[model samples]
Target: MLIFYYSKGSSALAAHILLEEAGANYEARHVALAQQEHMDPGYLAVNPKGRIPALETRDGFLSENPAILTYIAQTHPEAGMLPDTPYEAARVHAFNAYLSSTVHVAFAHFQKGARWTDDQAAIETMRAKVPVNLAEAAKLIEDHYFKGPWVMGDRYTIADPYLFLLHRWMEKAGTEFAPFEKLAAHVAAMRERSAVLRALEAHEIS
Candidate 1:
């Protein structure tokens, strides 16, 4: 598998960490979003949406980070990145949904623009709404399954890497994780994991 990504962003970071944690054999190809490489015709042909973190699998190309993560988890069930129980699987999906639909989109609108004509309004809206969504997501994580040092119970599942990446973005957004002690601790613990550390190092993140 080949993951085309930009290391500077959260989605790519999530995919990178997940691949590392799953012990998947994969190659990372850096797509320089800052240089607008994503807009090139070739890259756009690979992903018409012109997004980073596109996964090239034997079956086909997977674009969104959540889809790629789910595929990886499901493909390698022995890695224990996803839950076996139906309800637990739903909960994990819920977390990913909240991240994608809420936190991720919110940040995107704030950091990037929505429509050309609505950039200012979208930025202000995101600036106001993103914090609220992030806080709610963090609280839900703490209240629901923030046990045994992960988003899910004792197991270090796929959610940890995603949440960890989001936490780093939250810090950038000037939101303090202090309000969510459990989530904050989870981020710190995930940072210490050998796989996560190695992944970051391999990506030359920090």
Candidate 2:
């Protein structure tokens, strides 16, 4: 069984949802970020980076959503979490990479600005830019990346959960999604999934 450590409402939700979708035997261990338990000595021992969503596998621990999500998908091939074709699989990877590197990073600047700077003014500036940054990301995903219905057209892969997580973040940041009709519809469809509901309930997130 895998030991999954995560904080509620964080990007960890993506991996949590995927685990449910795969019907994997894993323990969801909550590392409360509000209490700063993630930075505690015991938690750090599991993930030295002190980041949420660390997975303890037979080999060792793995961090990062992209890596963990892929691991789960590959391990449980029967779940069909990843695409079969190499080119299509690479496309999924590319989309996930953008969410991790660009979209997630932009969202982080809103809540984790202190990680980048000590100046209060600079932190506020970063926070202020979050709406614009996320709006741009939403547009890019809508126009270029999103393939509709599911992230990769009819099939629901690991990318769907990641996109769902991002959509959640955008809502929290007070960014409007009215302009992106497809994204709005996508979030609605995701909400109907049993896996998403299970993950949300487990995470205590509405």
Candidate 3:
């Protein structure tokens, strides 16, 4: 059995969604961020970095959203989490890269500024800078990234969960994502999925 340690509605939601989609033999354990359970000794033992979304597998603990999501998709090919062709696969990965690195970093600056610096003024400055950078990221996703109804067009892939998580984060960060019509449509489509709905419930997101 796979033991997934996650924080409610964190980036880990993508992995949880994938697991639900794949119908894998796994269990979800919530690490309450509000209580700082993620940094506790027991949780730290599972992930030395003290991060949520650590997956304990037979091989050991697998961390990082991209790696965990890719592993689940590959392991359960019948779930069709990834596309068939190599080019399409690359496209999916390309989207994931931008979301995880660029877009995610931009979103993090607002609330996670402490990770960057100890200075309160500097942190506030970073928080203030979020809207501008987030708007750019949103525009990028609206124009080139979201191909309409989905990240990769009509078909839902691993990228959907990854992208949808960003939508959630953007909303939580107080950004007006409705301006990105395509992305908003994608969010609507995502909400209808059984896996996505179940993931929301599993994490008590609603």
Candidate 4:
């Protein structure tokens, strides 16, 4: 049994959506970030990093979106969540890596600036730049990473959910979508999926 530790409105949504998409038998444990449950002793023992979306497998706990996502896809091969080819699969990883490393980091500047610096003014500056940075990130994805209909073109892979998470973050951050038409269309398309709707409903997200 896979016990997934996740919180609402976090990047964990990506993995949560993938779990539903793959139709995995898992227990969803909500770690209340607002209540600081993540920092609690028990939760800390489960994940020293205190991060959401940690997977409890028979082997052990797996942290981080990319690793957990890959695990889900690999374990449930019939789901075809990943491409069989090496280069194509690497492309999927590359897109997800960009989201995790670049886009998510840009949003973190606004959401968790204190993690970066102690200066209040610097934190405020970082926060102020979030909208612009996110917008640019969206443009980068549209111009380079994103392929029409899905992140990896025709077949919907694990990267789609991560891309959808980016869209959700952009929407919540009030980042204008008028510029990235393909991304806007992709988000709309993702919303139509039964698994996507299930994940959104599970998270109590609109």
TM-score of each: 0.89, 0.98, 0.94, 0.97
lDDT of 2: 0.93
> Model 2, which residues run further than 4 Å from truth?
none
What's model 2's lDDT at 159?
96
Pairwise lDDT winner, candidates 3 and 4: 4
Candidate 3, residue 22: the lDDT equals 94
Badly placed stretches (over 4 Å) of model 4 are none
Writing each residue's lDDT as its tens digit, candidate 2 over 1-206 gives 99999888889999999999999999989999999999999999999999998999999999998999999999999999999999999999999999999999999998999999999999999999998999999998999989889999999999999999777778878998878899989999998999999999998877
Q: How many backbone overlaps does candidate 3 show?
A: 0
lDDT of 3: 0.86
Candidate 3 lDDT trough over 10 residues, lowest sum: 165-174
lDDT of 2 at 33: 96
Candidate 1 to truth, TM: 0.89
Question: Alpha carbon lDDT of residue 119, candidate 2?
Answer: 100
Order the candidate numbers by lDDT, best to worst.
Answer: 2, 4, 3, 1
Local distance difference test values of all predictions, in order:
0.76, 0.93, 0.86, 0.90
Q: After superposition, how far is residue 80 of candidate 2 from its true place, in Å?
A: 0.5
lDDT tens string, model 3, 68-150?
A: 88889998999888899999999899888888888888888887999999999999998887877777888987877778777
Model 3 residue runs over 4 Å out of place are: none
As for model 2, its CA RMSD to the true structure in angstroms is 0.9
